[model samples]
Target chain A: MNTTSILDIKNLHAGVAGKAILKGISLTIGPGEVHAVMGPNGSGKSTLAAVLAGREGYDITAGEARYLGQDLLELDPEERARAGLFLAFQYPVEIPGVNSTYFLKSALNEQRKHRGLPELDAIEFLKLVKEKIKLLDLNEDLLKRAVNVGFSGGEKKRNEIFQMAVLDPTLAVLDETDSGLDIDALRVVSEGVNKLKAPGKAQLVITHYQRLLNHIVPDYVHVLMEGRIVRSGGKELALELEERGYDWISRELQLAA
Target chain B: MSAVAPATVRPVEPATEVDPWVQPFARLESGALFPQQPAWVFPLRKAGLARFAELGLPTLAHEDWRFTNVAPLKGLPFAPTLAAPTQRLADGELDARPFARLPGDRLVFLDGHFVPGLSRVGTASGGGVVTSLAAAFRTHAGLLERHLTRYAHGSANPFTALNDAYFTDGALIHVPAGRVIEHPVQLVFVASGEEEGRAQHVRNLILAEAGSQFTVVEHYLGRGTATTVTNAVTEVVAADQVVMDHLKFQDESRAAYHFAAVHADLGRASQVNLHSFALGSRVSRHNIHTALNGEGLECVLNGLYLTDGDQLADHYMVVEHAQPHTASHEYFNGILEGRSRGVFHGRILVRPGAQKTDAKQTNKNLLLSDDATVNTKPQLEIYADDVKCTHGATVGQLPPEQIFYLRSRGLPLETARRMLIHAFAGEIIDRVRCAPLREELDRLVWDRLEQDTQIQVGPHA
Candidate 1:
């Protein structure tokens, strides 16, 4: 239950292939704080999340990202996951022939082992997953099915959040999780996220609209345009952006430059 | 063919007393077993035996078996076992074996002969029919004559011809029209006795009448008391609107050479799901042929083979789409350890005018040792222009990421590796529709994989 900043990304410049997507982005997420990143399309929001998750193909040209005072960029994607960093992908990869329950159990156990905690057996893991899945309102049948195979878009997003809850990562990044969800599904998913938050965990909510922000209720809202953070403010910034639209922010950033 | 001069082969050096029938190109017991068979079947069996005698046992020089050498058969003194099994059903120790609790009729064959006392012949819901092939040959001769050897032609492969020529006893399952069997029918083939180099040829024919549905599981087990050779052939026919699920689990003793051929035919709108699990035998070869002969038919073929030491396992399959709107899918995965070798050759052929055919095939191999080897080939020949067909093959060791992921979870290195291996093989085994059979095969495969390090020498190995 450390109250220090869990993730500190300063002047993060990252990109995929040869093109840059994240340009000098600075962010600091303290323990228990929920930060919302709202932007238009091509705004580098996903790039920030991907870079934080340590996904390949994204070259961090220059930046320093510290998670609990340890260099985050030096770790692999799975290592980052074991180090309490979870990314809820917008379009989660469908891994056929892999059972969802088994996958989540292995993932959770890997994280626990990294933290010097004992791993749970199948029965114990099933019990824990049964509880978490209930909170997400997901069907138990999905746990028996292949991971995200043939699942609806909304169900895949809910499953991602369910996995986040099971893993209990310190820094959870939700990248456009609300894109494919209906209003009710969006509320349920956001509620699942809110219920998992505690004094020791933080979340970075990445979205394209203020609708999700209204449900998740982020403590800080940042406006990203053209691969950089153009504006940062409290929760009201989301409402202002919803009213003013992203075109104004793009224009203003252009004008300021 | 005048015995063909041993086909330019020498008698195995220091060979044991060889049976006269073991000679290459020697016709033995021809036209003897089919005295009462139909006129057409009598000649068919004779022609098959003649062809088998002419070709002799397939050697590595043969195109189809280029990678599989039959040199071990040279040393075998394979005389047919004609005696009936004396063991009773209750005394057969099946209760303590895997797949014992499977819900269905059980037919046990010992030493190439059906043991009625050791079989449980009844329907799962008191509705289906399970009887011996010999009985079926008398009572349902018309049905047997019409479908037996219809799909698996003896002229196509020499081993298949030999099986057709010599097979004596096998299970015959017939599901009545509109009847759905709740449980699978288990056909267990066991090799027992102190006879060395004994050969057992088993032939099974399963017919699901129009609109009927059922499952059949065939198990080949070796008693390990003596070296044996098992040549088995199964022909399954699903009539219009019918469905059939078949699983073949081969856990014969390592001292046995197992060869099996399965031919499946599907009528209009019929469906068939077939799975093959190979975890035993010194050298095992499986030939699977599926013919979608009617419109809207579907067939799925999935297999898993795990081998170690010098053991060799080969799976060859062909799916022929003869009508439009038919679909076929084939998936095979193998795990090889030690110096074991595995081979997969699968082909999907869509005939002309079969426009809506959809076929997908994938064969993947995971080699755990540097000396372990795999040969995989997936061939698709489509004549229809508007058809969808795809084939893929991959051969490699376990993904390091997956192994490391499991190990990082505090599982011991060996346990983690074993789990990953099991998971790889489980991908195909899990496709088995019969739960009991699937579980049994899974356990047997795991046990065999574990024994690779402990037991290194066997007749088959």
Candidate 2:
């Protein structure tokens, strides 16, 4: 199928600090598609997300990742961000002394400058922020304070999504974004994610539980077991895994080995 | 591991001659101007001269002056600014400054001489006195006799003594008991750009009696490229049940030098806040000392310095608690860019009888370039058994995570770093009590930082 692919990974082999983790994993995400990577502990789901986002210290030994037909592996983290690649971190970092509004403006302006568009002024940017803040059910007061400095766990998760909404990346990799959410927070966060998915964009939702997937339904689900995707299927696979747990995948991977 | 020094006998450099800017000023006397003043004025000047002579100018050998070397002063032609009737600077020149219309009483000093035409000299609503030091030396000699020369005599700094000996004019403010001054009493000390290497010694004294309250702004704006030097000393006495705010803003010329000392004595249950902002000059040093002499007094010292282009800014503060139930806190932050340097030294001492003392001190520095440097030391000495004291100093750059987070939002490297730096500075700037004053300082500092960064990252650079 020759539909424009948002991201294409081929035989991705990555490691951290000289220790191999993501071994011989490959996946492809196309425009308008949402893919979920679910696995048990130590299955390298977050590693896959970090490697795709160009985080440092992850040595991609033998593989190729391309975004919009460009060499994604060669770009810096910031360059990748400017190229419309986003990653919602499992643990959003708390940056003290950095105002949320200022950070968002700088980020948006950089992207605009890269695209030869005029940057937005204060009034325009403030209006845009005020509108997007409500999508995640976040308080307007947080925009005036330091970024995620004293935010609750759920608030921080919602903030990651709020940043995504502002940047509007083409390919977003959400890594365990639902790790610390309750039923209400999970529904709000999933709804925010669903709002950002358009026909020309794609998302790779990384999680350890199917509860998040229930809120934000995925078109494709892959079971990553011991550094390899042992099973791939439609949305029904998630349902099976939900009832059977990860032992089925682990057993099948052992039998195949 | 023994690359070069392990096997060799080191060679020590010879000691150099004392900088000419050091001694002569201390010996100079201005007793003639105060001829009609009190009998103790000349003796105070003579004693000041003697004290300055004994101590002399500090060198790198002294721990206090280690980071600051006055050797650069030797190359500049040095002379004391005379009250020799130089041409007056136009009023328009003074009106163009950032804080031109402070909307209150003002005492204007141009080149160390009081100018009556520019001053809106009077008292606040509470019958306080805002007048020139020369005039107050005559009109209120008794009040000056009690508080004047008292703290100046108690100070250990040589510059304080030098100011007493040679200062031609300054401002004096007094607020009586059970009264409140609704507006700030401003002191504007401007250095004329007429002659190169000219110097001025300016002295200011402020006093508030029991149950009194007021605010004072010591504003120093140096114009011209003539390499001027302003040596200033201010002594404050806050009596029982009094509250006062003293803010000193110094934005001198790039080629100028500034040295200042503020000595404050607090009485029973009094509260005093001292704020120092240093943003100019090639070399500057501020010595701020406060004494908590009575029970349950509060002393707060806040300072911020911005330096770039080989500039050196130094701050030294000592907080002494001599009575029971006293609290003192000091906060100082610095942003050093280019090849600039910053130094901070803080000391808190609790005397034997001072029980239940609480003191806190913090000095944080941010270096924007590899060559920028900061030396910070926070010290505490407590003789009392029941006391809580804490001090910390941190020297760091824009945090990597902060930059990365910003960058991930599509911000360029330069913009992200600058934003982080500005926010770091805003932590201290936002603490200024006056809103307009805070906004003015914020704009000036932001503009300077942006321009400096642009120049630093030029194509050829």
Model 2, A1-257: lDDT tens digits are 22378888878889998898988887888999999999998999988988887776789998888888888999887899999999898988887677888778878888888888899999999888888888999998988878898999999999999999988899999999999899999999999999998999999999999999998899899988777787888888999999999998778767997
Poorest stretch of ten by lDDT in candidate 1 chain B: B1-10
lDDT of each: 0.79, 0.82
* Candidate 1: tens digits of C-alpha lDDT, residues B131-214: 888777788788887778877874356667777666777988888899988788889998873577888889999888899887
Quick one: best TM-score, which candidate? Answer: 2
TM-scores for all predictions: 0.74, 0.88
Error of 1 at B15 (Å): 20
lDDT per residue for candidate 2 within B125-175, as digits (tens), equals 447788898899888989888877787574666667777777778888888
Q: Where is model 2 chain B poorest over a 10-residue stretch in terms of lDDT?
A: B1-10
Candidate 1, pairs of clashing residues: B282-B460
lDDT of 2 at B251: 87
